[model samples]
Target: MSDPLVIAVDSSTSATKAVVVDKSGQVLSTGKADIDLLTPGMDMYEHDPVQWWESTETAISQACAALSDADRQRIKALCITHQRESFALVDEDGGALRPAILWLDSRAGDEIKEYGSDHIHELSGKPADTTPALYKIAWLKKHEPEVLTSAHKLVDVHAYLAHHLVGRWVSAVGSADTLNLLDIANVDYSDELLDIAGVTREQMAELAQSASIIDTIKKELTDSWGIPGDVVLVAGVGDGQAAGLGTSAIDEDVAYVNIG
Candidate 1:
């Protein structure tokens, strides 16, 4: 008998990659699809939310097609590891209200400067920077209050993909950490931070720890990919944390140094 299979998807800024792996951690198949990134202004970058989901679907479809029936049937998990800080505001039905702002976007410089403080840095474990999604959310609130206020959920990339895959507005705790939304020391969302970003707890995804099984892939999506609908969707962290986890750095003593 063959080993159980798992499909891991990485939804990145430039592209989405899907890799099928066996229980032994050997990759059986791989697929990738490019994502279109738009820069409307010098410091503003965005990606169509639709393209994020489509790229994921296209990548998975291509990866699964490369597997044999036996290998495919053994699939047990679908996990997603994605970019950090990028976020979108979605309607109740998981539809995007506007293009998702990318992590690289710096249009919220003024907001960052205004809200940037040691207290915020201590609370979020992130200093006011161009990378945190909080600043971008503030920018949205200032320029498009109507749209921002009307959103059913303010979510990061992981939450968006998780909703589309499993029909739940949930995000991996580690993945949402860098959004400048979480009280990292407590591993939970801070009401003060949410208020600062002009978002509410009711408008945020429920948080789950990394690798926890959150939900199952939707039947429609599974049927399209030729995978069983019962396959569990596992929660995953952002690329940085995922890399640390991959390198077996799960504690303070064990560190993952990324030397360029």
Candidate 2:
């Protein structure tokens, strides 16, 4: 038997990148697929939502295809790090209800001004900023009430991809925190935060601790990709935190700055 391998996927604003690596973090192979960014109106950035999963599949399949049968069998798990704050409303079967709002979207200015305050900042541990999903969700509540009320779940990138990979509606705590809905201290969804966005706890993805194994990837997906059928899906953090780990910036003296 050879050393085990894993797939690390970064689903970002522009593309999804898949890299196969050994236990020592050596890059064995890589693949990428772009995600179309839609600018339907001034200050609005959106994605078709379905493209999130599609691009991921394309990228991962391409990466796995480069490996020999032995290398493929060595693959044991996969994890995803994605753009923070981007999210979509989906039905029970994971169908998108509308275009997903991206982190850079600025259409929620009015809602941010009206609802942004010290109390919210204290609870969420994030200032009333354009990057958080809370304001955008409030925008939807006011402008698209039916869509808000009808959604079965409001999911960030981690939850959305995790569901398709593992057949569970789950998100990593670190990934979901960017939505500005979690109580920072409790590290769980907050009622006041959900109420402001017209959502309920039941409508949120089940939370998993970051770096933990949430569930196994579906055997059908693994079989199709020619990887091990028992490949598990590991819960992951947002891109910002992931970068820190990648750069070995875990100490108090070192800091990682991403200009891009």
Candidate 3:
């Protein structure tokens, strides 16, 4: 039997990249697709949420195209590492209600100042910074009340992509943690935080632990990729956490820095 293979994806702010790797972690093929950044106003950055899934599909298809039939059949799983704190509100069928808000968007500065405090920092383990999705969601609640109240779900990049991959709404704990809606100690969503964002638990994705197998990729996706066997989907973390893991920076004494 051939060695098992996995597809690893990094859906960053600028692009989506995919790599096919064997059990030994040797990358056999790779591909990439760019995402257009949308700026509608000062300090407002966004992306068409549809582009997220479309780019992912394109990148993965390109990567898997380089593999042989046997190699494709050997593929057993898929995992995603994505930009943290970016999010979108979607309807029940996963259609984006609007463009996804990017992490770098600073439009929520006012909300941050109003809501940032020791209590929030203690609950989220994230400083009172512009990066978390919490403040931006609050901004929406204040200014775009109709958009927030009518949306069926609010999801991070991981949950959005996972829905396209597996036909389910789920996100890894580490991935969702960057949203500042999680209770850091419990590694789960907090009611207090959700209430502050004007969303409910029903609006969140079902959480899964990082690195665990979540579910098999949709049959249509595998068929389109020319992969004959079931390819399980693995829960993933935010790109920052993935970077640490990629660099072997797990130990307390080690630190990883990205100059870029």
Predicted candidate 3 versus true structure: per-residue lDDT over 227-258, tens digit per residue: 99999999999999999998999999999897
TM for every model, in the order presented, reads 0.95, 0.97, 0.98
User: Pairing residues by index, what is the TM-score of model 3?
Assistant: 0.98
Cα lDDT tens digits, model 2, 1-260, are 59989999999999999999998889999999999999999999999888999999999999999999999999998999999999999999999999999999999999899989999999999899899999999999999999989999999999999989988899999999999999999999999999998889999999999989998888899999997559989999999989999899999999978998
Error of 3 at 158 (Å): 0.8
In candidate 3, which residue pairs clash?
Answer: none
Steric clashes per prediction: 0, 0, 0
**lDDT of model 3 at position 74:** 95
lDDT of 1 by residue, 193-239 (tens): 99988988899999998889998888898788887537898989898
lDDT of 3: 0.94
Q: What is the C-alpha local distance difference test score of candidate 1? A: 0.90
Error of 1 at 101 (Å): 0.5
